[model samples]
Target: MPSITRRRTANVGRPTSAETDILAATQRLLVNGANFTELGVQQVCTEAGVARSTFYSHFRDKIDLLVRLATELMTSSFDVTSAWKPSEGVERLADAFLQVVKVYREHAAVRRALTEVATYDATVRDFWSQELNQFTDWTIAVLRAEQDAGRTPADLDPVSATRLVVMGGERALVDHVTAGDPHADGAFARELALTWWYGVYRRPAHHGERSPS
Candidate 1:
């Protein structure tokens, strides 16, 4: 299967100045409490201090721009995840998760806008899911490696565990930022780290059976 992450402009790297300007502009409006659906391209271009033509050149539509923002945010989080080692203690993993939390908090507005837009937009929804699915693939690999190394228990199905953790962890991370409580961020990150560490990587034992599919 091809990676949704294999989409264009990915290997090309981060956005140029014009793209950054427009993305930053949309984030500003959302930060100021403007409804994302109510925001117009003209208003965004105006905020960006760029021409409407520039906006059109950079993005096909607002949904596209939101997807770009999501991509940037996910890339940062994935980079952090890549640094983590199963051999490292849960505290170390907590530190890695905290870095991810900081990334989300840094662009809390864009994060908020993307989630809101996704609710009513199928394109955004699928794009976001595909992005998470990409991470799920990476996570499954890591879990399998840990099992081979005798860290994670073999009883757990890596595929099923990866889906549950990736999807659930994505939602939890987004909600953690949305709640906007800095005080809870650390605890939340630690809890997530612990869940991944003991709940999967070091699970004691488990059992399951298949039902009609």
Candidate 2:
């Protein structure tokens, strides 16, 4: 009798349509409240209609997939806000913040998923940190230009002040979104923006009061 030998299958490195389907399905599941701990590779394969071996061929694990999805979300947000321009003094800031809130509210499912995942994932946290820093830098540039033109308070430090202002706006929106309050509207965002401006911009000295020259 002739000796029989079995050969191991070679790994083909190219991504297949099945892998794309799995990633897309995973994103949808995440948007629908399947927490990271609950997200298993098997479940993802089931949802995507793929075999277990197929998933392993594309991704090392669930965290790796989560990192990719989170990065996409952050980059998309940056793209949406890149065209932002302030029209009036503080109103511009208010409008810009409200725009962000509106976009998040419209896609609350995905936003909530990203928020929850970022809380525990270091990679997601780093992605958000970098994105937020970029946003703060952009805001500082706007404020600095206003200061140069005598629109903003001369005593304020543009860079530090802008960070504080952006933080306030960001937190206010997060609170509104997470609160899930039925009455939550653009009013809260507008108020928060105005409050920030009041602290950063100087009011003219009252008549008969000596200007602190």
Model 2 scores a C-alpha lDDT of: 0.63
Q: Candidate 2 lDDT, tens digit per residue, 84-131?
A: 553344556566656667666655555566577767877556656776
Q: Using lDDT, give the best candidate's number.
A: 1
Steric clash pairs (candidate 1): none
Query: What residue runs in model 2 are displaced by over 4 Å at the alpha carbon?
Result: 1-24, 50-60, 88-93, 106-120, 201-213
| TM-score quality measure for candidate 1 | 0.85
lDDT of 1 by residue, 136-179 (tens): 88888999998888777779799988887888988888888877
lDDT of each: 0.79, 0.63
Which regions in candidate 1 have their CA more than 4 angstroms from the true location? 1-14, 203-213
- Please report the candidate that would top TM-score against the real structure: 1
Go through the candidates in order and give the clash count of each.
Answer: 0, 0
